[model samples]
Target: MDSCEEGKGIRTLSTVCEAAETAGIHMVPNNPVQVLRFSEAINGNVRLLELNPEVEKSLKQGDRVVIRGLASDEAILCTESKSFEVKVVETSNTMLLCRDIQTPGKEAFTASQSAGGGLIRQEVCGSACSYLELRPCRGHLSRLAEVLSEHQYAGPETEPDNFVAGYTFRDLLDLVQGSEDELWTGLKRCKACCIDGFWRLLSADYFEQAFDRIVQSLAEKDWPIYEVPVDECCELLTDLLPRVIIEHCLTCYGKKNDNGATYCLDEELVSQFYAGYLLRRVAKFNYAEFMEVWQQTVPLGITVALEMLKGIALHDLTARPPVVWHFPANSLPYDVSPRFNALFQERTKWTLSDLRPYIEDLATPQQPLEAILLKHTRSTMDVTGQKLYNSRHPL
Candidate 1:
């Protein structure tokens, strides 16, 4: 009966491994374990190791260990076994060896405090292979929030009173009661820690205050902010402003990629030119002449960059004489050139006159005033070089 029970335990452990593999779970390097390189050759019963205080403390005389990268046939051993032993040869150095055989070159050793039962099978050979299966759930989150609120203010004197989420971490450590080095590992293993931290930082009150603070700061700023009408600003401010504020804060704090709120609110709140200027200013918040040398090329750069991205570019020095899409004859990117050249070659919709049918299809209201003005003053050269008074601007 005892033999049968032992066989069942082995089968159960094998089933666990199979299930873990089926679930697409695998382990990467974990921090609690130290990876040490063999510093010297093993002679007799010992070999010297490179200095590592953490490794020395975690390992014990009777701990089970697995060494990989030594040879294909490397086997598991216990520290107290006749074959294996661990020794501290120096203050910062450790040694591992087996009797009668000298292991060649640097080898990887993993030792765990856990021994007996099915632990060796799970932790097999100190590779630290373990499944990451914890997932956030509603029950855990509610409990985590309650726990965090209770211990939100408990922090060391060195921690600032106003530090965000300060007390919550202490609460987590207390719950786990792990050593300082093990605290992070413990927290990572528990989904509650993540849930609590996320909730604490992203509470409704926190979001409200952050938004208000950002708006107030932006409102009071002295720099040219590319003003838009109040109603238009309000429409976009609620949804888009918070992200801009975060980007600005990241910049102010030197956290990087901080060009926040550089664009006008997207409903044509400000002209593209003014928006670009604001972007340049925010990118160089302190320097008045930032991008000075490159500034001269901005208009051309904008045109070229836009052309490359959209397969065409447009610019208007004056709205009175709109300069719409213009490319050299038959010149454009491969994917775009065919369609663009065909439009001109086919001549079905090349001129503004040909575009009238499409404009009419849009069901636009007839502009009597603009029609009168174009009829009275507008003039253009026709295909035969004869000037005509009825031609309107192509926009």
Candidate 2:
């Protein structure tokens, strides 16, 4: 015990003596020593887990934490509002989980002395060689589009009994591996509406028809196409579509103005809607004809460009007549490897901007957009020197 005066193992004799002199510890051990007796049955069942500050705080607050994944998928740990990829990390140093083990405090030493003549009997309950670790990960939302597709809302006339049980908010929370906040965001992003008691996407044909009515109504009343009045649009369209569905469309297609009274249709979203409508109706359209028709299909004065269709459609210049087609990014895989395989099969090459919308969800601050491209794709340039990306591996 005296030898440990200048060593690292225990609180030094000097420290204890100093503490005694200053009355810092009420019961200063006359002899700062403890005898540890390991149990015959050494246990190794204990688990060592690590938590970040945010996770620790969430745990302290008694928030819900869950591990979610399919059998084929890598598991993720989700807190009430965030998610992290769960990993098993091996450690080099030996770590023991010893029960009844305490610092050589006077109370502990006294307890030991009273029990068995200064013998501090302790037991090693576990030894750790690995620990559970967590790294922040994106929420699992890729399947939302597909899962919600099963419950598409065509219209009120086509809708079944509203009371029928289906995948409601809680159901989706279980079915999809996302926190409530993120799942809510994903639902909104997919234009999913709560009908009766379930979540569903609006069917394309019906949505297109509803959009047509909106456009025609806007043209008839000479309402500003850019900043359409919200309440009036909903009032006029309530008979055609449910008011909730009408509001959902308004929220999806546009941003509310400063006063929140009117909603300005976002050009990109509007253009993408019409472009998707055009591309979906046809297997392929001549690149030139598609461009001309795309511009004409959108509401008057709203320009449609090839750039806006990056996420909604694909331009295949290699085919005869150099065609463009409906190859939505949402339909592709979220994982980089399979996503690239699909991309290559659809088209041989892609410019960076064209490929970004499909893969940007996988990018993080540490792994930016270019890093993913660098790892999964081989880059080159055309005759004009515009950079391009193609799959690094052959399918």
TM-score of each: 0.19, 0.80
Model 2 poorest ten-residue lDDT run: 28-37
What C-alpha lDDT does candidate 1 achieve relative to the native structure? Answer: 0.31
Reference-based lDDT, residue 56, model 2: 93
Tens-place lDDT digits, model 2, residues 1-395:
75763475545545555665798666433443333444577676667779998789989999988877677877778888888888989889877777656565657766655564332335576788888998887788777887888777788787556446358887787777777777887787667878777888778888888877887788888888667887898888777777777667777888778988887888888888888888888888899998898888877888877789788887767678798889887677755677889989887888888888888777866678888888889999999999999888978
**Poorly placed runs, candidate 2 (over 4 Å):** 1-35, 39-43, 70-73, 92-94, 99-123, 162-165, 316-320
lDDT of 1 by residue, 226-325 (tens): 3322333344455544443343222222222124424222212112222233333332221223223223422222222222212112233344443233
Collision pairs in model 1: 51-92
